[model samples]
Target chain A: MREKIIEKILESGMEFVSGEELSKQLGVSRAAIWKHIKALREEGYNIESVNRKGYRLAERPSDLLASNNICHELDTDIIGKKVISFETIDSTNDYAKQIATNENEGTTIVSEEQTSGRGRLGRHWHSKSHEGIWMSIILKPNIVPYKAPFITLIAGASIAKALNTLGVNTKIKWPNDVIVNGKKICGILTELSAEIERINYVVLGIGINVKTMEFSSEIENIATSLYKEGYNLSRVDVVKAIIKEFETLYFDYIHKNSKLETLKVCRNYSAIIGKKIYILQGEDRELVKCIDINEDGNLIVEKDNGSIKEIVSGEVSIRGEKGYV
Target chain B: MREKIIEKILESGMEFVSGEELSKQLGVSRAAIWKHIKALREEGYNIESVNRKGYRLAERPSDLLASNNICHELDTDIIGKKVISFETIDSTNDYAKQIATNENEGTTIVSEEQTSGRGRLGRHWHSKSHEGIWMSIILKPNIVPYKAPFITLIAGASIAKALNTLGVNTKIKWPNDVIVNGKKICGILTELSAEIERINYVVLGIGINVKTMEFSSEIENIATSLYKEGYNLSRVDVVKAIIKEFETLYFDYIHKNSKLETLKVCRNYSAIIGKKIYILQGEDRELVKCIDINEDGNLIVEKDNGSIKEIVSGEVSIRGEKGYV
Candidate 1:
C-alpha cells in the first residue's frame, strides 16, 4: 500500500493530489492515505503536503538502495526482473548461491555494503558501506560448464560499456576487470555448480567502486573509483545501464551463439591491447605483448622471443609493464 | 566404543574373549561391555555366547554398510579417512556436497539406497535398496576447473582395475562408465563447485550394481549387475578395493600432475577402443571408429572419411554401434 501510494504520487508529476482523490484512486480511506504518507516520510521520502491539498512526492532518497529506486524505469527483459535489495550483507554471491536452486535466472541481489566481500581466486575485496556496487546475479544458462568462462567476459564488456555510456570513460582489462585511467575500478568473480555435462547454476558477482574516494595503502596505488576519478554518477543509473547492456549481450551469446557485439566492445574499449604486459604464473613472470582475443575468448599474446601464444583466461594473471592495471 | 568392541572381537581370530578380560583391556565395566555387545548384536552382527567362555565372532552381516566393515584393513592414507554411512538418502552426492566445505578432502559418504539417484546430464539413476554401492567421495584437489573432468576418468579407471583385480573381467568406457560383457555394471557422476581459476570441491558419485538380479524394462537391455553377470562378490570387498585403488591414482594425479597411470588403465581395459561407436549430440548421431585416448583423456575417433578428430568428455555421449554402452 505504501509503495502504491508512492507510485501514485510519483505518477502525478509533482502535483498535489487531494486526499479524497487519492482515496478514490487507490481504494483506501483518507485516514489510511494519511498514515501511509507519514510512513513514507519516515522512510526518507520527502513527500510534501499543503493545506487543502494532498501529498506530492517532492524528492526521493538518493542514498537509499531500494527495489523501487533501482527498478523504477529499468528497461531490461531478464537481467533485473526481480531485484533483492539489502542494506548490508556478508556477500551477495554467498546469499545468491544459497537460493540459486530455487530462484529463477537473472534474479539480482544487491546490497549497500558487504561485510566480507570476495574477489577472484579467494582474495579479499574491500567493499565499504555504501561506497560501491556490490551485487551478484544468479544465472542458469542452458549451456554446458565449458561455456561458462565467457560469461565473465560478457560482464566485463557490459560494465565498461555501461560506464562509458554514462559519460565516464572506462576500458575493459581483458577477462574480468574494468579499469579507468589505467587504474582498477571493477572486478568480476564467476562461480559455478555443475556436473560433468551440465551447469546447475552460476553466480556472477560484480563489485564496482563508484563513490569510494579513500583507499587503504596496500591498494591505493592500483584501486580507484568513478568519483575519485572525477566522474560523479548515481549508482542506480549505473546499475540500470549495466543491466540493459548485459541483457542484450548475454541473450545474444546464449540464445544465438553470437559473440560479435561483445567482442567488438571488448576489442574497441580494451586497455591492454598493443601494450607491454607481464604474465604472472606463481613464481614465474614473463614479458609478453598483448595481441587480440580470439573467437573462443582466449587471449593471444606475442612473447619476447617472437613466438605467438594463446593464453586461456584462468591459467595466469596479466599486469601492465610497470604495475597493476 | 561399540566399533572398538567389534574390532577387539575380530582381532581375537575366532577365539572367545571373556567379559572380564574385555572390561580390563578396554577400561569399561563388564555391564558396559555386555551392553555394547547387545547393541552390536541388534545392529546385525553375529556373535555366539558359550557357557564359561565369553563371546566369539561367528560372522559379519554382509548387507550392512558400516564404517567398521568397509574400513576393515582398508589400506589407504587419504581416500577413506572419514567414512559416513547411511541406510537411505536422496543422493549420496547431495549429502556429500552439503558437508564438502567443512569436511576433509577425502571424506566419503555412502548409502545402502538412494531414493533419488542422479546421472550425468540430468538423467535419473535407478539405485535399488541394499543391492548396490551408492557412494560419493568429496575431494578438494588443488587443480583448476578445466582439469576436473579427468577425475571422472580416474574414478572409472579405479573401478575397472579393482573389478579386474577381483577376478571379474571389466572394461572402462572411456570416461565414466564400467561395463562387463559390453553391458554397463557401474556409472559415475562427478559434480564440481569451482571458481574460474580453482576448484572448491568435487563430489564423485559412484553406483555399482553388485547384487541386483532384476532391472526395469527400460534399462534391462543395457544394464546388468555383477551377480547377474556371475561374479557374486561381497560388497565390502569391492568397496575396500576401489577405495585403495582410487587413493593411489588420485594421489598420483593431484600430487605429481601425472595422467600416465590413469590413462594407462583406461586404455588397457577400455571397452570402446577398437569398436565402431555412435557419438550422440542432441538428435544427431555420427558413426565413428575409436582410435585412442589422448594424454588429456579426450577420445580420439576416426570419421567415415578417414579423418581423425578429438572429442572432449562432456560435450557428447558415446554409444555402442546400435544401443547404449
Candidate 2:
C-alpha cells in the first residue's frame, strides 16, 4: 500500500493532490492517507502539505535505496523484478545463498551497509555505512557448472559498460574486478551451488564504492570510490544502470548462447590486455603479457619464455607490474 | 565407548571375555558393560553370553552398516577418519552438505537406504533398503573450482579399480559411472559449494547397487546390480575397498596435484574407448567415435565430419550406440 501511494505521488509530477482526491482515487480513507504520508516522510521522503493544496512530493531521498526509487523507471525483465533493501546486513552474498533455493531468479538483495562483507577468495571487503552499493543477485541459469565462470565476465562487462555510460570511465580487470584510472572501484564475487552435470544456483555479489571518501591505509593506494574520484553520482542511478545493463547482457548470453556482446565489451574495455601483469598463485608469481580474452572467456597470455597459455578464471589473481590494478 | 567394546570383542578372536575382566579393562562397571552389550545386540550385533564366559562376539550382522564394521581395519589416513551411518535418511549428500562447513575434511556419511536419493542433473536414483552402498564423502580440497569435475573421474577410477581387484571386472564410463556387462552398476554424483577462486567443499556421493535382485522396469534394461550379475559380495567389503582406493587417489590429487594415476586407471579400464557413442544434449543427439582420453581428462571424439573435438564433462551425457553404457 505504501509503494502504491508512492507510485501515485511520483506519477503526480510536482502537482498537488488533495487528500480527498487521493482517498477516492486509491480507495483509502483520508485518515489512512495522512498516516501513510507521515510514514513516508519519516522514511526520508520530502513532502509539502498546505491547508488547501493538500500534498506534493518535493523530492525523493537521494541516499535511500527503496524499491520505489530504484525500480521507478528501471527497465529489465527478470533482473530486478523484486527488490529487497536493507539498512544493514552481514553479507548480501551469504543472505542470498540462504534464500537462493526458494527465491525467484533475478530477485535482488541490496544493503546500505555490511558488517561482514566479503570479496573473492574469502577476502574481507570494507563496506562502511551508506558508502557503497552492496548487493547480490540470485541467478538460476540452465547451463552446466563449467559454463559458470563466463557469467563473471558478463558481470564485469556490465559494470564497465554501465559506468562508462554514466560518464565514469572504468575498465574491467580481466575476470571480476572493475577499475578506474588503474585503481579498484568495483568487484564481483560469484558463488555457485552445483552438481556434476548442472548448476543449482549462482549468487552474483557486486560491491561498488560510490560515496566513500576515505580509505584505510592498507588499500589507500589501490582502492577508490566514485566520490573520491570526483564523480559525484547518486547511488540510485549507479544501481539502476547496472541492473539494466546486466539484464541485457545476461539474457543474451543465457538465452541465445552468444558471447559476442560480452566478449566485445570485455575486450574493448579490459584493463589488463596488452599490459605486463603478474599472475599470483599461492606463493608463486609469474609475470605474463595478456594477449586477449578468448571466446570461451579464458585469458590468453604470453609467458616470459615466449610460450602462449590460456588461463581460466578462479585459480589465479592478476596484478599490475607496479601495484594492484 | 560402544565402538571400543566392539573392537575389544573382535580382538578376543572367538574367546569369551568375562564381565569382571571387561569392566576392569574398559574401566566401567559390570552393569554398564552389560548395558552396552544389550545396546549392541539391539543394533544387530550377535553376542554369545555363557554362564561363566560372560560375553563373546558370535557374529556381525552382514546387513548392518555401522561405524564399527566399516572402519574396522580400514587403512586410510583421511578418507574415512569419521564414519556416520544411518539406517534410513532422505539423502546422504543432503545430510553431508548440511554439516560440511563445520565437519572435518574426510567425514563420510553412509545410509542403508535413501528415501529421496538424487542422481546427476536432478534425476531420481532409487536406493532400495539394505541392498546398496549409498554413501557421501565430504572433502575440503585446496584446489580451485574448475578442477573439481576431474574428482568425479577420480571416484570412477577408484570404483572400477577396486571392483576389478575383487574379480568383478567393472569398467568406467568415462566421467562418473561404472559399467559391468554394458550396464551401469554404479553412479557418482559430486556436488560443490565454491567461490570463483576456490572451492569450499565437495560432497562426493557414490551409489553402488550391490545386492539388489530387482530394479524398476524403466531402468531394468540399463541398470544392473552386483548380485544380479551373479557376484554375491558383501557390501561391507565393497565399501571398504572403494574407500581405501579412493583415499589413495584423492590424496594424490589434492596433495601432489597429480591426475596421472587416475587418468591411467580411467584409460585402462574404460568402456567407451574405440566405440561409437551418442552425445545427448537436450533433444539433440550426435553420433561420434570415442578417440581417446586427453591429458586433461577430456574425451577426445571424432565427429561425423572427421573433425576432432575435446568434450568436457558435465555438459553432455554419453551413451552407447545402442543404449546406456
Candidate 3:
C-alpha cells in the first residue's frame, strides 16, 4: 500500500493528486500516504506540497539502475540491456570486471554503496553509504588496444553533459574525473582484455556522489558531493540521465561511424582544453602553457621555453593557474 | 660442503679442481663431494670422472633456474627480480595480477604448474605439472591505458626470441600465443589499470609447456609442449631466458630511442611473418593473410581482398602454415 501510494503520486505527473484520492487508489489510510512521502523525502526526494494540494513529483532523482529510470530513455542496443543493482558492495568496478569477461556487451552493474571503493592509481574512493552512485558498463568494441583510452574520454564527456543538464557547470579534470566548482564529483575507470586486432571486452566504472552531506576531512578540499553543492538530487535521477547520455554517445560512436562522432565530440569536450595547468612531466611538476589536446586525447602542453610536449597518461594532474572554473 | 664443491667446480670454468682441494677449502671430506656429485647427476647435471684425474666438468645441462643458468647476461634495469619458484599454483597469472597492483616493478612470480591456468577470453590454460614454465612478471611501465595492449606484443616477442634461442621453430599467433607444430605451446596474458594518460601497473603472465606428457583428450589436438616435440629443455632455463629477453626489451622501450629497435627484433624473431591466420575480428571470426610486421610489433593482417589492418590484440590463432613452422 505504501509503495502504491508513491507510485500513484509519481504517475500523476502534473497537479497534485489529493491524499484522499491516493488513499482511495491504494486502499490505504491517508496517514499511510503521508508516512511514505516522509520516508521518500528523507531519501533525498524533492516532494512539493501545499495547503490542500497533496504531493507532486518535483524530481525523479536520475539513477542508472531505477527500473523505469535508466531504461526510460535508453536508445542503444548494446550499452545497457540488463541492469543489475546492488545496495552495497566492496567494489563495483572489480565486480563488473569479473562479469564483463563472462557476460556479453552492455551488462550494467550499478550499486548504491561501495565500502572498499577505489579510483585510478589505487586511490581510495570515499563512497559513503547511500551518498554516491557507482556503476559499470560492459563494452565489446572492435578496435586496437591503443584506441581503448578514447572510451574514457567519452565517459567523462557523458558525465559532464549530465551534470551540465542538472545546472551544475562541471569541468573535465584531464583523463576521467568530472569536477564541479573546482571540486571532483565523479570518476571513471576502465579495464579490458584483447588480442591486437579485436577488443574482448571493456568494463567502464563510473562513480558519482549525487547526495552527500559530510565528506572526509582528508579530501574535503578536493571532493564535493552533489547535495553538498546545494543540489540534493536523488541518486536514481542522476543514473537515469547518465545512461541516456551515454547511449546517445555510444550509438553515434559505433553506428554513425568507427571514428565515433562521440570521438569528435570528445576532442571538444576534453577537460584540459586551452587551460594552463601543471603537469608532472618527469620527476618535476612544471607549469605548462595551454596549447591543444591531441587526437589521441593527450595534452599538448607548451613549456616555459618554446617547445611543446605531448603529455599522455600518468600523473598529469591539471592545476588551474588562477582558479578552477 | 657439497654445495661449495659444486660452486668451486663451476666457477673454475675449466678442468675441475681435485676433490681434495674442494674438501680442504670447504673443510669437508672428499667422500662428501662424491656424494654431492651423485645427487647433481640425479638433478640432470652431467659430471665426468677420469679415474685419478678427479671430477672434471664435462658438460653442464643448461639449467632452468640455476643462478648462472639462463639470464646470465641480463641488461634491463627492472622487470625481472625476486623470482619465486613454485612447484604448482592455482593460477600464476591470477596470483601475479592480484599482487601487481601492490608490488613494485621487477617482481616476478614463477611456478612449475598451474592447477587452474587461464588463456584469453577466459579460457582454461592446460599446464601439465612439472612439464611447463608458468610465470608472471610485475611491470610498472610509464605509459597510458591505450598503450596497454602493446604489452602483449612485448611479452610475445620475448617468448618468441627465447624459443628461437632454444632451437624451437615457432610462430606467434598475433596478440599472445606461441605456436609450434601448429599447436600452441605458450600463452601470454597482459592485465593492467590506468586512465587515459597513465598506466598504474601491468602484470604479464606467461605459461609455456616445456614437457607435457599427460594430455587432456579435449586439448590434445590444439596444444603441444616442448618436451612433446623432442626439445630437451629445462623449465628454469626457459623462465630465465624469457626474463632476460623481457628485461632487455623493456629497458630499450624506456629509453624511447631504441624502443623501435627492440620491436624490430621482436618481429624478426616472430615466426608468423608470412602465414595464414584467423582473427576473431570484432563479432566475427575471419581468415586473414599475415602480411607485414610493423615496428610496433603489430601484425599487419590482410583481409581476403587487400584490406590490410594492423591488429594489436584479440583472439588470434595461426593456421597450420607450414605445419606451424
| Candidate 1 clash pair list | none
Would you give the TM-score of chain B in model 1?
Answer: 0.90
Ranking by TM-score: 1, 2, 3
lDDT of candidate 1 at residue B26, scale 0 to 100: 95
Which DockQ-derived CAPRI band holds candidate 2?
Answer: medium
Q: Tens digit of lDDT per residue, candidate 1, span A1-325? A: 7768877887788788888998999898999999988987876788889989877877766655667787887888888999988878999999999999999999999998899999987899998877999999999998888788899999999999999999988988888689998899998999999997889999999999988999899989999999999998888888888989999999999999999999999999988889989999999999999999889888899998999999999889899898886
Please give the CA lDDT of all the candidate structures: 0.89, 0.89, 0.71
TM-score of chain B of each: 0.90, 0.91, 0.72
lDDT per residue for candidate 1 within B1-325, as digits (tens), equals 8877887888887899888889999999999999999988987889888877998789877667777788777888988878998879999999999999999998898888899999877789988878999999999999888888889999999999999999999988878789998889998999999998889999999999999999989889989999999998888889989999999999999999999999999999988899999998989999999999999999999999999999998888888896765
Candidate 1, lDDT over the whole model: 0.89
- Candidate 3 - CAPRI tier? incorrect
TM-scores of all models?
Answer: 0.91, 0.89, 0.67
Q: How big is the positional error of residue A174 in model 3, measured in Å on the Cα after superposition?
A: 4.5
Off by over 4 Å in 1: A1-44, A49-56, A60-63, B1-39, B50-56, B60-63
